[model samples]
Target chain A: MARLSYLKALQRALIDEMSRDESVFVLGEDIRVGVNNVTTGLLAKFGPQRVLDTPLSEQGFTSFATGAALAGMRPVIEFQIPSLLFLVFEQIANQAHKFSLMTGGQARVPVTYFVPGSGSKTGWAGQHSDHPYGLFAHVGVKTVVPATPADAYGLFVSAIREDDPVVIFAPAGSLGVRDDVDLETLSAVPLGVGTIHRPGSDVTVVAVGHHVQTALAVADQLEGEISVEVWDPRSLYPFDWSGLAESVNRTGRLVVIDDSNRHCGIAGEILATAAEQMRLTAPPRRVTRPSGAVLPFALALDLACQPDAEQLVTAVREVAKD
Target chain B: MEASLYRMVRLIRRFEERCVELVRSGDIIGGIHPYIGQEAIAAGVCAALRFDDIITSTHRGHGHVLAKGADPIRMLAELCGKVTGLNRGRGGSMHAADFSKGIFGANGIVGAGGAIATGAAWAFLRQGGGDKVAVSFFGDGAVSQGVLLEAMNLAALWKVPVLFVCENNGYATTLTVSESVAGTICGRASAFGIPSSTVDGMDAAVVFEAASAAVESARRGEGPAFLECLTYRFDAHHTWEHKARVRYRPAEEEVSGRLRDPVEIAGGRLDPAERESIDEAIEALLDEAVAFATTSPAPDPSTALDYLYGSAVLP
Candidate 1:
């Protein structure tokens, strides 16, 4: 068994994919120098041609990735901040995402947009703290948010290998997580699948990205009182709806804890879909940031707005009540 | 070179004129952003390109697509939103594309094609293929977009084989270049270390000479070049103005603008008899193109998401 940190897992995935395929290249600002550490050791191994450092032009490089994909190359673009996704939304949604269909299947934009530190990194204020996987999912771009080290490595590999454009959001909260894993067992995980971290009969707590750890901890704390099933949906867009339904069928209750804003958030989609299709004995609940939340600069203000373990525990209990 | 350039300009002129007639007759649902005056730029640049070379075009993009070797009938069908269109009716006039011919697409968003072109060029060079250069055609208005500037930097930094063809047609939707642009346009490229040249866009030969040098430079792996083609629009920004009559340029300016029609300039290079024959040939080609476009069936509504993803469905 080897200890693999979440950040190291991301690096391994990039190293593996770039080595495995000559068409795989990495591009972003400061990535050549490995400023974010996720692309560490890639430039030295693959050389400058494969690992490119781009200018501070998110829209330009993002669309450039689309063009590269059209020309028969797969590009993994790294974004230093999660909120930079807002700047290049048009490139991803309008250009890259629409290319396959718009060109009548003549093109496939297999560009993986990698956001190293997603979600609120306490005190980073409004512009830097957005978790926009929901936006990508809404636009039908394959969106993934991996909680554990193994899942991060596996999901990123899958995103890179996908035929369409994929956005992988690596939450800042989950980046520090380390896990004991057998190196031989680590492999590419299929997108649109849910992994039950811990199974229980009482309630199914659907969590995303960093919130999966919180759900698992809450499940552990209230072991006997409320048996909790922690479900992590690796990919957001082609979400494991069937797997979610199966979990809900067993538990008969659902609670989604997502970090995005409440209105039109992934949590809302999960709860609404569960209510409509699944056999939920009680009304589902969601724990998310308030609608249109702008994370303030102060530590307390930022923490106050973000969903935490206590909120997840309370939502789990609330869903179990009915 | 002169004969081909003349033929392309003449073909584009006749093609656009026929397109306008179709618009009046209610065939082309959305009237086009006519490329009547900017023909030389497309003809000159595309003449310098290899068949495998790629190009991304702008809103007024018929000339570029046609010059890049897309079938005129398919392009016209695209304007008419038919199944036989280059994009199968998914892309209308503003979005027409023939990827097989290396015309990535005709982007509706101003200044967006530059980045895509740069990316394509980079990819081509990275793949160890024959030095395939990409040409991005945009208007004076595109100079104002931040993405274009960013693309210039990326192209220059990476030494991507791309030609940034800026068709300086004086006005961006009635705003004159003098009023809108603060600093010089070519200086933007110069700042990024991209060698640039300004040429007489109305003279197809002059544009061809400049583009040939730039395209040659890119093919030899010398990096990107920017060509600022000084030209003017012979028609309105769009056909909607045919009735709206929004006045911007004075009558004198309009008279002077039409003085150097790209078609006439290029056609003058050929013998009188040869020019007449070319015109007749172009007319016949346009006639067949219109017939093909109009008779083609419109695309069905059900298969809207037909090409959304490359892989087959999971089930």
Candidate 2:
């Protein structure tokens, strides 16, 4: 069995889709050289036509992908920096994402916005560091933040195959994650589906993106003390609310761990939804970056802004008391 | 060719006049950005292309949509927000589109559609065809938009067939090209090494000749071409300006600009009878379109959220 890294898994997914369908292609800045190694070997394998190197214009290429998708081609756009999503927010959220509905379903922009190295990367600083997946999910773009190697491969492949536009955020932290599995068994994971890393009876800890890995580690540390169910909602926009309900129904207590802002973050929504629809014994708690949280230049302060395992453990401990 | 151009400009002229009436009557919810002055540009540019060729329009896009062979009745219905509209009323005046007719859309965003046209042209080139050319119709205001400039670079690099038509109708709403645009519109294209031209946009014949040459070059795989059409807007930017009383362009400029009317220029090419027949035909067509639109039923509010997603199940 070979160990497949998350970045390699994403690369494989793109290669497989490009090979399977001729209309599928990748376009972005420096993808010809495969910046950050996400698009490595794609230019040589698929050639320059299929693998295009666009100018620094994020809005132009993003809308170009939408236009290409309108003309019967599937384009997968790679953004090296996460903040580029902010610059092209209108291009994605307003233009491509709204194309289908705006055109009365006549236009289906099957463009994939692949953002590798999302969130903080130590000294990347304020301009470069951002996880705007919550904004897309809020505006109803099919958003996915895969937490592992296998999930990255499966969700990315599925996003390209989808008829609508999808934004895939491959977190910088989880890029090194590896899964020991047979290459043939790696398959497509449908959107709006959630996965349980560890089933527990006491509390349901809903995690997103790379936070699932932390939730699992915390679950491991609290094994004898508390049985925690680590729930990873692979697709955020078309959120797996039903799958979440099933788990919260079993545990009767919930705690959401997310890297987004506290105000209107995924964690806040998870807690609110669990309270509204699911059976919960105690007031559901949430661990998130403070409202309007900006990651500072210093490493220590940057790490402080992101939700950590320590806060999750304390939230879990507090919720378990009820 | 002259008769068809005359007919199109006349049809657009009357269609816009009726649209203004509908706006005043409150039949149309949002007042429209009337394409009253720029009829010749749309008439000539569309006439130079094939039916399969695509065009992306701006907010003042009724003339382009009509010239590209969109059903007037359905387009009017769209402005009325009816189910039978082109986009089924989801996209209103600024976003009216008919994919079947190759009118990608009338976008609200100033220069956003340029890149979309470039992408379509890129796709067509990738498919190894010379028959198709994508046209992006914008304004003098869009000349400086970063995305439009980026799109030109891509189109030039890929040698894709894209015709960038800039209707330099003096004002980008209230701001004049002199006030906002610093450099020459043609100079911007020339810097990209793309072949460009400046034509009298008020005359259909001049616009047709310029557009025809550019379209021919694009079809020959000569990359993208730019056309800066120096025309004038005969109406307010939006019908809302009627009540808001925003005075931007001078009354003298309007008086002098109306001297070279697109309708009179195109109509002058034909005999008196031909001009009268074209005018009568357009009036009847617009009357029918107005009747069709006014009678069309609005879509149900309950289904407002329908088609928000193309997935099997809505989230």
Best by DockQ: 2
C-alpha lDDT score of every prediction, in listed order: 0.91, 0.91
Per-residue accuracy of model 1 over A34-131 as CA lDDT, tens digit each: 88888877888999999988879999999999889899999999999998999999999988888777776777889999999999988789999999
**Per-residue lDDT for B1-315 in model 1, tens only?**
778899999999989999999899999887889999989999988998889999999989999999999999888988998889898888887888888999999988999999999999999988984889999999999999999899999999889999999999999999999888989899899999999999999988898889999999999989999999999999989999998999999999999999988988998889999888888988898889899999999888888788888754231
Fraction of native contacts (fnat) of each candidate: 0.69, 0.73
The TM-score obtained by model 2 is 0.99
Going through the candidates in order, state the TM-score of chain A alone for each one.
0.99, 0.99
lDDT tens string, model 2, B1-315?
Answer: 999999999899998999999999998988999888899999999999899999999999999999999999899999988899999999989989999999999999999999999999888888775579999999999987998998888888888899999999988888988898887899999988999999999989899999999999999888899999999999899999989999978889989998989999888889999789778877887888889888988999999988888776435
Once superposed on the true structure, which residue ranges of model 2 sit more than 4 Å away at CA?
Answer: none
lDDT of 1 at B137: 95
TM-score of B-chain for each predicted structure, in order? 0.97, 0.98
Give the local distance difference test score of model 1.
0.91
Give the lDDT of residue A15 in candidate 1. Answer: 91
